[model samples]
Target: MDIDGRKLKILEAIIRDYIETGDPVGSRTISKKYDLGVSSATIRNEMADLEELGLIVQPHTSAGRIPSDKGYRLYVDGMMQRTHIEPEIEEIILKMIKDRVNRIDTLVEETAKLIAMLTNCATIASTPSITQVRIKHLQLVPIDEHSVACVIVTDTNSVKNHIIPTPKAIDFNICNALTHILNESIKGSTLSQISLDKIRVSIEEKMKEYGTIAGSVLEAIDKTLHQEDMPDIYIRGANNILDFEEFNNKEKARELFKVLEEKPYLLQVLDHTPPNTITIRIGEENILTPMKDCSVVTTSYSIGEHTIGNIGIIGPTRMDYGQVVSVLEYVSHHITNMLREMNDS
Candidate 1:
């Protein structure tokens, strides 16, 4: 059966109310709270139609109705129009993200935190793969006589620091010379291009005396490049998940937490989203069993040409679709722009 505009409005109101108050919505509440210009009896009839349509359900026969997965799906797919984020809130999000754009990992981490704060939902972020990222500059700073900090700057404006053991005699002057040699040899080359043999040959030819230091640097670079297994996954505001009534059951909440602790599960959740678009997976629609009761809103962010990483928010199925969609879309767009600027500068 086709739902009329009036019925749609009533369903939207119920979803919104349930999202805010975490309770079943009744016709009286809709009549009092929403200016639908309809009487409670009329709303009751419409809600009955909606419940029959399987859009909303009552936990108990005596209780009012709450949005079912079907209802939330309708809201997300058809009813949830793109809404503008308030200027003040947008600015705050952009400012927080801009401050961290100098480094890709930092930017991803901060984006997760900002999304969690703004959405009051659990947020997850994954760092971009550097395998294809070219080295912009390589600097070796002597930490002491026995250690050196290998600072690798990528063309995507990501900065990574790896500390390596070095000869006790190796000082700043020697490190400076090695830095020049390393930069000249590997600058503008992708991480894949800076192979161990290539680095070993280059370093040994130029500074054989500091071969141990060169080996250390090469090890750091290798570790950095082949870091596909550990893609800096970040989680923020996980505690917020408990704030929702859907997760109020201790066993259910513990199960969700246990699944979240598995990095592979989190990776799959974030990776499923395509770049430059938003995806909403409602309860039972989620591939992960533990997340079956939850809704995930995800959007991918890029640094340049590379579809670097994704940020996602996890909340109850009753999540405010319009608000979460707008926040994720805006933040993802801002991150792309800021990162592009970082590269250009």
Candidate 2:
């Protein structure tokens, strides 16, 4: 595809104007606002040629032109100026990670929501499955007469608490013994193999008086360990999607609203993207029906050697590619680094 330098410049001007004003652009507007140094008639001729080449399109017979999907693709892939995140923004993001250091899932969710709010775009983040999480340590705290709290620490340094009620009161010594026994047996095993029956047998053999306590603890561990399959999905600023003037149509707005609420649809969208790379899916390239008018930029975050989750930005096809891409890149890198530190800790 041979795009002349002048034609590329004209297309870039139209894209920039449309993105700024949310209005179909005309040669007069471009010639007036931009230093194209060309007459409106000459610019119009170039726009017509750009349109013929599928780089721009006229929304109506007399309306101004908007960049076609092809034009936006070219601008994003080849012409749009790249942006770097400001130092202040980087500081804020790092501070957020530090504040939520103990909670990796919360860290991911808050980071995505913050970025979405800052950028005025919908943000989605997926953390790695807890099923892949290995247990690092387990501590049992006595909560009350009949209940004990099971605190599980994973290899990722995430702690989860589960409270289990026993049939009767168990003293502190028994609780400590049970905790030691359970940790010794299940610490290195995957969650699925931490069978309650096996735990009961070990407890009965060790201390008959604490059999009931052991059983309850085993139940709690089973519940806590299996909890990893449900990965968290955070969507922030979904309402921002409606702010785009292009989605003023009631039907289009409703369709997008519904899709955003559907977790499976968002996961499918993220899953389609390759791991660990920023993917820019422009309008019509999106597989989802409602997302056809939107664009998505996504990249995965990892913990050391494993990809743990993905984070992405969602906006209109006219989204500022430079800003969105930079934000996603910075956020993804920061999240990965935070996760690695968390695992190390």
- Per-residue lDDT for 146-249 in model 2, tens only? 88887888776677778888887877787788888888887855566566788799899999877876776777667766764667788998888878988889
**lDDT, each prediction:** 0.85, 0.83
Each candidate structure's TM-score, on Cα atoms with residue i matched to residue i, is 0.81, 0.82
Instruction: Estimate candidate 2's RMSD in Å.
Output: 3.5
**Tens-digit per-residue lDDT, 103-201, candidate 1:** 778878888888899889999998876664678898988787677888887776877778777655678888898888788878877666766777678
Candidate 1: stretches off by over 4 Å: 37-39, 140-150, 162-186, 192-220
**Which residue pairs in candidate 1 collide?**
none
Error of 1 at 258 (Å): 1.8
Question: Which predicted model would earn the best TM-score?
Answer: 2
